[model samples]
Target: MRQLKIAVVMLLIGGLLTTAAFFLAFYTAEVQRFGTVTLSEEIDSAYPLVGVSNEGLQYERPWFSQKIFYFHVPVAEASFLVLILSAFFGVRFLTTRRKEYDTKSRIAMETALTFVALTMITGVLWTKASWGVWWDWEPRLTTYFIMMLLMVAYFVLRNSIEDEERRAVYAAAFAVIAAIDAPISFFITRLIPSQHPVVFKSGFATSNLLPFILAQVGMLMIGYAIYVMRMSEERMRERLEVAKEALED
Candidate 1:
């Protein structure tokens, strides 16, 4: 109970911090200009929104997609981090063959998937706002989309198997493989020419870092809160199952 109280507190704190970050992004953070066309590009080129001007200043970049950074980035990072957590638990379950660890792994994966879904939704919004399109078959986006499918497949595979031990083992094995996509999703652009902006290639503006950090920490806290809550719920369900079995006996 005390732990659950702590989880609740954590959730509230996370929500507050994320909200604060969202507001700060618009008010205090330095607005960033994303692109300036190279000298090779004609000064009188058709793409006027990007390129250096005669006055020697970068063209005004849009901030509409930038606002999504606070929300989308945090959630996306949280998803990847939680996906690692789930994979770690999956490893633990395989070594231990313990139901408790399996339950933890399953719950963690579910939480990861929830965050991934949020990431995808926010990503699409960023896509529309920034790229002016609904969807694209780009490498980075495709990588995550495949990652989500693999996660869903892991559960479906678990459901198909009848034996408890076998199900846990198979799910654990699949989860580790699924996590490969997590890193792939992150670094996909580095390996190839891609449209996704590489934020770290140059670095973030000093003013942008604070809210970004705040949002990241908040998202991590929220992810933990969710994992803890799900573990509690799974425990309760286990207890109910035991009671049912006892009644039948």
Candidate 2:
């Protein structure tokens, strides 16, 4: 009960902080600009031509879609973290053949799927808003889209198996594979040419950092809350299962 209470409190805090981050991004953080807009008239000209500027209607680009970064990047990071966690617990379950570890692994995967779905949704919005298109088969986007399908396949594979132990083993193996695939997706996108922005290396303004950090922390808190809340529900379900077996005996 106390643990659940703590989870609720953290969930509330996460919600409030995430809300604060939204307002701060809107009012305090500097408005972010999209990709560099090349000027038609000033290819060999001054430094002023690089930005999304309005040089009397000839070179004006709208600075939009930057607002999505605060929420999107954090959730994306959180999703990756959860994927690692799910894979870690999966490895542990395989090592020990323990039901508890399997439970944790499954729950973590559930949380990761939820986060990844949000990442994809936000990413689509960013793509549409910035590139004026709903979708593209860019490297990073393609890798993540594949990753989401594999994640979904993990559950599908589990449901198809009748034996509990076999299901757990297969799922654990796939979770590990998915975990390996995620970093490959991220770095492979970097190694190859892609339209994706490498935000860490290119950097954000100092003023933008605060809200981004706030959103990241708040999103992780919400993630932890999700894990804990799901664990509690799973434990209750297990207890019900045990009660049914006792009645049958």
Candidate 3:
């Protein structure tokens, strides 16, 4: 009951912060020119030329498509963070063989799945806006796709097992292994050539950074609220099951 109240409070606060961030990103934040193009070939006469460089190259200011970053980045980061949390609980479950830890791990995985799905939705839109494509098999995208598959597989593995303890063990082990891909996906752009922008490497202007931070913090709070609410529901269901079994006996 207390947890439910706290979850409601967090949901309200998180919703307000996320809404404020969205408005600020669209209005108050300065539109950033993410990439500048230097024309090597014969430049089109209709191109919006910013200026000419010292080497006599035409510099064209590209269209602003970075607005999606405010949402996309925070969701992506939250997904990985939740995945790690799931894995942490998974590890604890393995060491202690406790049902509560397994429950927490499962709930965290569910939250991660939610964040991952949102990341994919926003990522697809960002990809279309930036790369002019709906999908691409780049390193980051491919690895994240695989992570989502692994998350799905975790639940499948859980449901397939009839023994509760065995099911928990297998799911916990799988989650730990799946978490190994998170860092790989995160650093893929730095390790190899990729079209994805490295937001942290270049840094951000004050106007851009504010909304980004708000979105990130708000998203995490919402994610936690979701986890808490789900856990509460699960506990109620467990109690009902116990009562039903007692009455039947």
Maximum-lDDT candidate: 3
Q: Which stretches of candidate 2 lie above 4 Å from their native place?
A: 35-56, 59-62
For all candidates, the clash counts are 0, 0, 0
Better of 1 and 2 by lDDT: 2
Q: What local lDDT does model 2 show for residue 204?
A: 80
> Which scores higher on lDDT, 1 or 3?
3
Estimate the TM-score of every prediction: 0.88, 0.89, 0.89
Could you give candidate 1's per-residue lDDT for residues 132-232 as a string of tens digits?
Answer: 89899999899989999999998899899999999999998888999989999999988898898776796887778888888999999999999999888
lDDT of 3 at 212: 94
lDDT of 2 by residue, 46-71 (tens): 32344544542133344657889999
Q: What is the C-alpha RMSD of each candidate to the true structure, in Å?
A: 4.7, 3.9, 3.9
lDDT by residue (tens digit), candidate 3, 137-228: 99999999999999999999999999999999999999998888899999999999988889889887898899999998999889999999
Count backbone clashes in candidate 2: 0
Candidate 2: lDDT over CA atoms? Answer: 0.87
